[model samples]
Target: MSGRRGEAGSALVEVTWLAILLLVPLVYVVVGVFEVQRAAFASTAAARAAGRAFVLAADPAEAQQRARAAAAVAMSDQGVDGGAVVIGCRPACLVPGSVVEVQVSYQVPLPFLPDALGRQAPSIRVHAEHTVPYGSFREDRS
Candidate 1:
C-alpha cells in the first residue's frame, strides 16, 4: 500500500509537469492567433472605411485627408496603432465614376515577448484593400 501511494503521487506530478509544459504554450499560441485575427479584421475595416470616405468627399484634396482620418480611426477602434495606410485613385480622383482604393497594413507583435525579442520575432502583418466608386451623379468641376 505504501509503494502504491508513492507511485500515485508521482503520476500526479508527471501530469502536472505535462500540463505546464504543453498546455501553457498551447494557450499562448491560441491567444496569439486571436490577436492576429483581430488585426486582420481591423485592417479590413480600415480599408473599407477609408475607401468609402474618399469616394464621398467632394474634392480630391479633401478625399485624401478624409481617407487617412477614416483609416486611422478605424484601426484605433480595434486596438491597433501606427498602422500604415495608402490611397490610390483610378484615372483622376473626384471625377464621377472614378474608383478609389485604400490599403491598410498592420504589424501585430506577439504577447508576453520583450521589446527586443518581439522586434526580432517574425511579426504577423495583416493587409487589406478596398475599392469604392465615386458617385455618378456628381457634376464635373473641370
Candidate 2:
C-alpha cells in the first residue's frame, strides 16, 4: 500500500522532467521553422524586385547590374542584411520574352535546443524568376 503511493509520486516527477526535456527541443524546432519561413519570404521579395528591374532595363548588362542593385535594396528594406543576391542574365537567365532569374541565399542560425535530432543548420537558397514587359517612354528633346 505505502510502496504503491511512493511509486506513484516518483513516476509523476519523472514524467515532469521528461516533458520538460521534450518540450525544449520541440520549441526549438518550431522556432527554426519560423526563421526559415522568414528567410524565404525575404529572398523571394528580393528576387521579385530584381526581376522587375531587369525587365525594364534597355541594356542587358546594365539590366543585370540594375537587378543586383534592386535585390540588395529590397533585402535591406526587408531587414535582411547578411545574405547574397545574385542576378543571372540572358543566355543564362533572360529569355527572349524579357524574363530574368534572381537567386537569393541566406544563412540561418540554429535555434537553441537539444542536438539529438540531427537537424544540422544549413544555408538556404531561394530562386525566383519573373517575366516583365518593357515599359515604354517617349524620348523628349527640346
Tens-place lDDT digits, model 2, residues 5-59: 7576687889999999999889878887887777777778888888888776666
Residue runs of model 1 more than 4 Å from their true location after superposition: 1-5, 116-121
Tens-place lDDT per residue, model 1, 44-129, is: 99999999888777777888888899988998898888689999877778787677788899889888776684457657888999
lDDT of 1 at 32: 95
- By TM-score, the best candidate is 1
TM-score of each: 0.88, 0.64
Query: Candidate 2: global Cα-lDDT?
Result: 0.66
- Candidate 2 is scored at a TM of 0.64
To one decimal, what is the Cα RMSD in angstroms of model 1 from the true structure? 2.1
Model 2 worst lDDT run, 10 consecutive residues: 133-142
Clashes of 1: 0
Candidate 1, residue 89: the lDDT equals 77
Best by lDDT: 1
lDDT of 2 at 15: 91
Error of 2 at 27 (Å): 1.1
